[model samples]
Target chain A: MSSINSSGEPAAVRVVGGWASPFVNRVVVALKLKGVVHEMLQETVGKKSELLLRSNPVHKKIPVLLHHGKPIAESLIIVEYIDEVWASNGAPAILPRDPHGRAVERFWAQYIDDKIPPGIRVLRGSVAQDKDKAAGEMSTALQHLEEAFVECSQGKQYFGGDNIGYLDIALGSFLGWIKAVEKIAGVELLNEAKVPNLAAWADRFCAHPAVVDVVPDADRLVEFTVQHAALLRAVNVPK
Target chain B: MSSINSSGEPAAVRVVGGWASPFVNRVVVALKLKGVVHEMLQETVGKKSELLLRSNPVHKKIPVLLHHGKPIAESLIIVEYIDEVWASNGAPAILPRDPHGRAVERFWAQYIDDKIPPGIRVLRGSVAQDKDKAAGEMSTALQHLEEAFVECSQGKQYFGGDNIGYLDIALGSFLGWIKAVEKIAGVELLNEAKVPNLAAWADRFCAHPAVVDVVPDADRLVEFTVQHAALLRAVNVPK
Candidate 1:
């Protein structure tokens, strides 16, 4: 899928990301949506790579898209870059053309970024003392997300209406982890009964060809979650 | 400054913000830079306005830009909207025209958002036990910011090279607060010896005509800080 730029030269695209990271998957899904060919360099947890460190010295985190050897960090920013760069390549529009619609999409994306971690922590907690409270908070967060889906989707299949866009990729990357979280917590956080729109949206998102190709196997994610549950709980313990 | 759209109707612009909020000032500066006319609705901290609540139902936060009765929340997002909406209005460019440059600006803006809060917490801490540690962390954070300015500015007057851009607006909004924070914490965070480039950039940013028009008075900010320090410290105290 390497294409000629305005200079009539082939475009160089590469992504340095972690396999298990939802943030990384966001970039992968976006690239696939744009039909851009790129190499993915997997980064190992607990060990930093020279290229990753060189590319993103400040954050030193994964999901760095190296476009022509220049790195762009932060998953959302990278996704926006992909959308803008590949905009005229006949790829699907990830962001709305109008400023207001784009801003709305960005607002929800940032909300998801801020809200999802706590929900994940709720599911990660193993202690019975915190279970109920955590679950309550997680449920409230999920409900807020459901409301967002309702408002943005507005009787459509996705947030951008009739297609997967920025918000879908941002939140949908968590499909595998949400499944693992539900099983570990033994609570149905998302369902047709609770958040019908979000549940259906998730199903549609997971079934997308691009999403299907990038999302990690559900069983592998579950196994990883079980193995790391104790460590996650230890880290999430109240200070 | 109202202009007719394609429909031949005047644009209605309103800003719901607080006097002492750095986030609010960001929008104010952007509007001033874009030469857009906007009514500024000052929001009382303890009492949010009906307009704010109605516009930003999810976050219910200030610095919401109401354009044609539609509300766009979040400071950075609002700035982007203002820039995009006024792109052809011939105002000075707040963001770079090129995709790569815009992405770099956004990457730093996000960095500023993530790094500045911890520094603010350090300044808000009342106890001496945590002051040194917090100060150390803040200094490290500042150093990282300084590195960014060096890389992005490349000896230019601003992050966008001789012009105040998105990053400048984002980080420059905190200049007054940084002054208050330094006085309250009894440490100079930005100086000639350390982060000289950022210090100079802050001076240039504050001195800009648009920034001068919107920035809260330094004395007023200091007084406000002194008044709110105790309340802020109480909230900042870790559980």
Candidate 2:
């Protein structure tokens, strides 16, 4: 096994992430949970730097973590890399030790990551002529998500239970977005009556210290969204 | 470290995958790389049985690996899980230890995975007007992909290097579909002259033993495409 650095610090971890992107937040949560201190560089979707572009030439998107000038892209991939490097005994690892249990958590995280984006897509396209069609699609996706949460949360506090693990970090990033999406779309995905467990899970997830600490300013996020909403409306992009 | 069980196997691992899915193939490649003996169940997509449905009720998708009856869903997630569990000391892992390298590879994988489908979307839409728009969208996406390949390869043998790794495995799954897409759409994303490195990479990928041994029957896939091509054409789909 590799020895921990004498300085008790990871080798200069730096994160290039946007304030409003839940995708970026997943990585932040992982870094925090693993107790890895990183230099957080604020970025925006529209304005990418040469460093960001060069570091991640293919995607050229934020949530690019530069560890000693080496970059890792994609939020979940970064999380996995974090787990592998910071394998401190008894420290909060992002993955479950049991392979099966780990897989279960991973399955739910992927489900939520893939499906939940459509609701935001719907909200982005709200003013379109086919808004109803997108809404229906978003609604079905949310229904599936609600079902997913019920199965995932059965007999567990977090997705891996007790301490917040991979799934919690994965889903926790979206809690802020869920409220924003609901307000923007005028549709409640996680209604108290419709999905009590998920609603509760969201509450517990937001309350996690690791999550609460790293999330961007909620008011700022709302302002960003309001600005973005206008931009979408002007372009008639339908998201 | 855990002791290897009798017969030198770490433990019994099984993959629930569909023959038609690239997602499932990602896990298959990882298992082969690690030299883990496991069972492979060929599942029918969109027509899953109770076992699969129950195993992954949230996503209800295949590429669910049951290690000692514990299910892991999502292809990339399964790949990571496989790497974590069956990883050999000093042996190749799908992701790089270096953060930046890992990030770049992951970002492209996610970008290609998310963006490439949109190109296919234009081919899949039924409207007459939609077909032309889809072609244009697809062309632009391919342009980005070709340019990305030129930038990312930087003369590296594989996305990870020398041997196939995560990014190669991720993109390799799409090659089988690309030819069919090109034939049907009458548009070439990877011409020999246009994308020599990518074209060469695809060739090297297909001929790899791990990729060749377990890949679904190409002839059968082409036959399926042949039969379905007319139907897709009738709808003015990509075919």
lDDT values for all models: 0.80, 0.68
> Candidate 1: how close is chain B to the reference, as a TM-score?
0.88
Q: Scored by Cα lDDT, where does model 2 land?
A: 0.68
Model 2 vs. true fold: TM: 0.75
Question: How well is each residue in A1-239 modelled by candidate 1, as lDDT tens digits?
Answer: 34445776535888888777888999999999989888788765556689999998887788889998889988999999999999999877999889988999999899888867566656755444466676676667778888888888888999878888999998898777777777777877777788878888988999999899787766777777677667546533110
TM-score of 1: 0.90
Using Cα atoms, each model's DockQ against the true complex is 0.81, 0.45
- Residue range A63-119, candidate 2, lDDT tens digits: 788887677777777887888788875577677787666766766666766666655
| Winning model by TM-score | 1
Query: What residue pairs are clashing in model 2?
Result: A70-B100, A71-B99, A71-B100, A72-B99, A72-B100, A72-B103, A73-B103, B123-B238
